[model samples]
Target: MSAALDTHGKAHDGHDDHGDHGHHTPTGFMRWVTTTNHKDIGTMYLWFSFAMFLFGGAMAMIIRAELFQPGMQIVTPEFFNSMTTYHGLVMVFGAIMPAFVGFANWQIPMMIGAPDMAFPRMNNWSFWLLPPAAILLVASFLVPGGGAGVGWTMYAPLTTQMGPGMDLTIFAVHILGMSSIMGSINIITTILNLRAPGMTLMKMPLFVWTWLITAYLLVASMPVLAGAVTMTLTDRHFGTSFFNAAGGGDPVLYQHIFWFFGHPEVYIIAIPAFGVVSQVIPAFSRKPLFGYASMVYATSSIAILSFMVWAHHMYVVGMPVAGQLYFMYATMLIAVPTGVKVFNWVATMWKGSLTFETPMLFALGFLFLFTLGGFTGLVLAMTVVDVQLQDTYYVVAHFHYVMVAGALFSAFAGVYFWFPKWTGKMYDETLGKWHFWLSIIFFNVTFFVQHFLGLAGMPRRIPDYALQFTEFNQISSIGAFGFGLSQVFFLYIIIKAIRSGEKAPQLPWDGADTLEWTHLPTPAPYHTFENPPTVK
Candidate 1:
């Protein structure tokens, strides 16, 4: 018999045939509310992330609108600042991060030939914790004195002066941190302890390997963020002075602590993205991943180097020249490993049978735009150039290129790549391509000009600018609106696929060789790998 079938001719290797398991599966709303099934929780995480993405996108609209024609046409400067702050917070914690965790939840067990996450109930808890935290974060906007206007970094002193909203933000951070730590623990345990009998450590898929590294980054860094916020909270209410200059604390101390956590948090978002690209590029190229072992080493190197370069963000905040030099060199060092991964991706597609599927298109977009972002990052890595551009729109452009192009684009690619398996329905290919073209074009239209504006000395986080900077701002605002509309179209495409698209075959992509594609059925099963398939 084939590995996917039994002598009786019923599919037996945990195929999508779930008739026998129906009774055991929970139905109705409570299935999502109380269930520990990794797939269900993964679904929840994805939807939640999308919802937050829209919410954050709306805030971006407000920010863009206010800056559409210069002098604060729509919102008060204070509210504009709040929009920028919450927009960053929601997108980072609520949208991008959760989306990847969703991917991890769905793919890890299937990829490793395991039945469920290591801590199923805790998995349930980890997801549930997020809604309350999101509520706290969003609700802060309505609290007395409005939302915390201190950037997402929640810098001290300013944070200490904010009202009840700051408390809500702090508490929300605490809850979110708890959730991340729990999720990391679960991921680490599952990947480390639950692989199939013959799948050695180095034998795992690139996605699994990337996530393993990200989980450790989360475990190491989340507590630091929690501690930073807790100290801010105490300084606010208890007269403690961890960041209060009057109490012998230096505010710059807060920058040091926050960046230590912050820099790793950047990779906590980007590394999984690198993993997604790793999987998509290889599959679409119809080739095995180039330099698989080197990719793994490069990922680890990036993580290790992430810790050494936190002070780069602090160079302009008044570091000694020696400190600046060390950080400058350290920041530039990240490019080496990042370059290796980029080289391997291109080499994977070299002379290969390449096709421009939606996933592949987005992966290629990520490769080009993310590398552009990295180059700009190198420009800023120099202490002298950074001193000139810190807090300018140049810095803003670099960040979005890395973030939107790097993380968000890869996320879109992963969604499209796995959508067939997840929903057992193929999306409208035409619409998928439309979404890609519109997003990539408008994304560049929005951010590319910001580089020039920053070079001309347009500072970020401000509502208005001088007339000299007006044209590029107008161009950026228009592009922002167009980019926002493209994402809405993306939503429509996803819903249409799930409800009325063509049914997908069991193996949708010929080049995909993971266990989920090779051994499981389309849409996957309520239970998979009940009996693990040993890897060669």
Candidate 2:
């Protein structure tokens, strides 16, 4: 690769111009193998995340199929357990987290006028770590006893009873942790150290700010998870019994440690979605983000509050009344900052020149549905209510609303919002609308009934159910299939857009205010900001 040149044909260190914009991009397979370019790495991350999405969706199909008629007609009870376990693990770690990281890789540098990530080689290493870790996770299922059936949480005593698959899950978690930590460090360094001459921290884009907070959340919380899982591994193999009551260790200790990590892990997935919505809402509304300073504070508060509420997930575990009360209030307190965010988004869109582009549609969908999820979560935060609903299908409905409808929808918004810049081509608007409507309707079809199921007494993680629960289960199953198939339509839209969609203008969205849209070239020069751009 040759040295990159600026728009004026001068490199940063005053070298001569490189031949063409694409001149330095290595040809053939080695391009992906050896490149340190953030765009290429980001593209790889996005594609990898999508592949895992499909794989995890397939697992979900198996699960829904087994639950369709309440008789275990498809998979065995054991396989059903494994499917549940890995489906959660894959969707969270493989699909959602990495998709955001991919967005960071592609956008952060451009957004802030940096040429590449601060630690370029380390960025490459971080992404490459995911595939091997993913392999360990997927390969675990083919082992003699199938994968860990202990659910993604891998609670302690249940974990100790697992087969070789547990070991693989442990390793995969460790590797994924390492990758996340490295990626966080890279994001922190790039945003902190590599911004243009005048781009101060307060002046950075909201997406950049969200990532900065998310990276910290990852750094603070991943180690706790690592420690919890490591103890589980020891109990299973070396007989340390860190969670064994016979060895004077309480299983509740694992819950404390895991949720300490798990609760923030929720924000780690969500804050970025918030960032995406922040960016998209303003762009479509033709207004500045309504509360930039407040948005930053709200995000920071949410991250801080995330730590205090980890115990909310354990209200049913027989903690003390005082402990339950404290967690309940702390959990509910999260709604303040969250409500601030929702208000700010609506205010940004208030009476502005709003347009219903594909991205804006998804962002609006996220706001409506995520708020519904939040209300349900608030209901669960009530200690008395949670005890009744814990481990039931109600719990399932709450999170899918937050995760699939919330995080995943915003992710789609981000992709559609940025698709033009990424490919320098417009996606088919008609097809995009079709995909969104189908997803919205089917997603509701799938999980909405589970709310009633939980209220009426249906336990989760069970292969079969009582005859009274059969009708809702069948409805939910059919909805799940329709939702899954909608993505196939989504995939086609994306491919068609990339191959032969209309050529997008340099600033595809007229409301965009960021440097990437204002200053960068269409298709974004393979090498961006070779000469650092002035923020003003």
Candidate 3:
């Protein structure tokens, strides 16, 4: 294998320019179905995730509409529960996870100078599994009892009592977990084995580092989730007593098992977001990341600690005081690594040539809001506090801050940072800023008040609220509507960029040090790094 010219128009890979590698590339719809190209597959993953985001967002709109005036204005209580259940499911599984995977599909190979994923066909299969799972999930809403009314947590006793919709949710969970495990396997294999010759373990970019860690977390945790759901399925039909207290089973045991997987799942959503912010902040600030090695260690530390803290979520279940103290302390330990990451990001930007481009703006939003979420999480980590706030809107507010601010905001930053590279066209900057500011303002308006509602004794996952909770719910609903609509501007910006926009420069940003910018073509070629580029 000979090397080729990198996007720098330099001989980073000493191969002949075998121009236009698309001869083997297929065309049209069948091409998408049958293709194994990482770029094509990544594009599919992104579109699918976005469609799910929209579908889930629509469900959110219904939930908010019902709560807008607290009188069952839009949906029945049962259907409201269904909306809440599937909304959480669709957003977490269908939206956030796939979005990160889509990024992995697109960037990981380019970042590591690998030709493609280690198992490209498995990569394709991993993505293809999601649609059926999503279909079953959505179709459950039309079934006899509507969708599962239990929350996305699907606590056992409630889960066992639901109708066929519960069964659909269980099956959907199994399929989704299978997809996650396969995707994790592919990522781990590629990151481990397929780096270009000179890219050592420590030499890879932060995004690669984060995914490598995230893949491990996925492999470790997804199966536990699968086991939990499988037990649910058995209890539903196979006469198993895994969670039925009437049959010598313990519902608290279900909570234990579920949170074991659930706590780690939080970082599974978050670590990749950390990776994105790590890349973007340094890029716009024109500084090397302040503590690259420390960043890696902190991330790993967080992943390690995630497994130890699951029971913090179950403090209300009357666990032994020793167990509660241990989990609470362990959960609090997660803050050390997370805070290190935040500090490093701040230090990287300190006294540097910081520019608030769309990506930077979003990254800043992520840092600020995510820190606030972290603080709330600390409060919730206390056994006594969590006992009070466990099922309230406070928990809802806490996670949305983390999930939306941490994951979704960073995802937006990533799209803006890389969109030019992906599409060969620049998005409208003014519109981009508009989207960011509106989203940030309205997002705070939405969830910020939920903290008050939770403290004021407003419960979550409920369709109607008492008169005392009325004004806050109304404010939150309005904000939700605004936040939801701002994403339309985002979609428009993306479509406009793809269809007709200014051509992007090969190096669109000023300070990026990664191979994707340093080596790849302006619009990255269909087949890249055919001959791996040796890292310095």
Candidate 4:
């Protein structure tokens, strides 16, 4: 009973008593296969996300392997296109999307002192939809026409020409986007309505606040995407001229709607990472976050700015010069609020007694390298400069710096930071350190040179390139392979920690001061906060 109690010694006697024996545990494979407990749903999200991560990484490996030799040694042009398309789709919708949701599923109810997500069964529906959708995306490769060869953006006419696989991929994107909207709404309703009686908005943790911001973005952006993609579907099958220039519709219009949905989605991924690292750094640095109020305002500012900057991605699409300049300058303005965030995080650690735990290492790495990515983004923000760099390897290097080094690294940070709380077991600090160092080193080695390759006029998405670029390509391929392999170490550390490790305490780190820390255990119980603990 003591073990089962919330920190306040509250015990649940099951939601209802079925018989003398007990209430059902919702046993067998169906528990995961069909159930919707936040914990179970969170497990599904994390595993699904990891699978997507591995699969996406494999696609990258293929791209790297193909690029290993200069002249399209291993694959044809068609197959190479599929690899890039699916990799981007899988990484964005399948991997990164679910990871943030997984955090929401696991942490929101606990953090907000709710019994569970508001629509538990709908939560089940939301998660179950993912595998089917993912299968559709993956199965696109096997279809008679090959996979969607157009990029994940699925720009029209080119996409319209692709095989049956493209149709399946189209349907899959719509489905995944819908699932995300549903989940975001649930998170919104649950956080807003189900919070404990006294927990005010500002009192909520940064993680929750960021999710709140994210869910709003999701609710607003996803439907526009659904509508746009749905229209794309109609244009392909139903003879509408929405994105078909030949049918009196301008193809450029699709870019506008797609990006309307697209730009906010970037922050949908990064804001949660912002929340996660915000939590990790403060804890390890033994200080409350620096400028907590500013951090909140900064996050809100980033979200607001997301809507206005969508056109920046389309700078080279031959928009009027005035339009291009407006986007460029407005996009450049995001850096100010973003800079506020980076400054606040550093200030959080400044002059504090700090520890070099794995999470903190990853968090710090995120700050440094993600800042580099942001700077490159600023460079790309110059409309004149972007005319030269657009669609080149420079753009490739810039975004990968942002997405891979930024979002991916932050996910690793959160996992390490929260591992003890999730598993009630202590990970081997030394192995974690090794994993961190090797990953950061290899990651930089792989992508940093890509900027040079791009500026040298090497385009992205090619199966092969000119002979002059061979050496860096080879070294990059080697680094890419090493980077993927090093994840084995990360996996081993997690499994080892799960199976057997030193026991961890509720407040495993001295400075972990959240309500979740106080109310839960080293590995939190399956259902936490049956009755909300009074926040001290």
For 181-218, candidate 1 gives per-residue lDDT tens digits of: 99999999999999999988898999999999999999
lDDT of each: 0.91, 0.90, 0.90, 0.85
Evaluated at residue 5, the lDDT of candidate 2 is 17
Name the candidate that leads on lDDT. Answer: 1
Better of 3 and 4 by lDDT: 3
Q: Which stretches of candidate 2 lie over 4 Å from their true place?
A: 1-26
Model 4 misses residue 403 by how many Å? 1.0
TM-score of each: 0.96, 0.96, 0.96, 0.95
- How many backbone clashes does every candidate have? 0, 0, 6, 1
What digit string (tens of lDDT, one per residue) describes model 4 on residues 274-331?
A: 9988898899999999988899999999999999989888887888988998899999
Lowest summed lDDT window (length 10), candidate 4: 1-10
Candidate 3 residue 360 C-alpha distance from true site, Å: 0.4
Number of clashes in model 4?
Answer: 1
User: Local error of candidate 4 at 180, Å?
Assistant: 0.4
* Shift of residue 119 alpha carbon in model 4, Å: 1.3
After superposition, candidate 3 runs with Cα above 4 Å error: 1-25
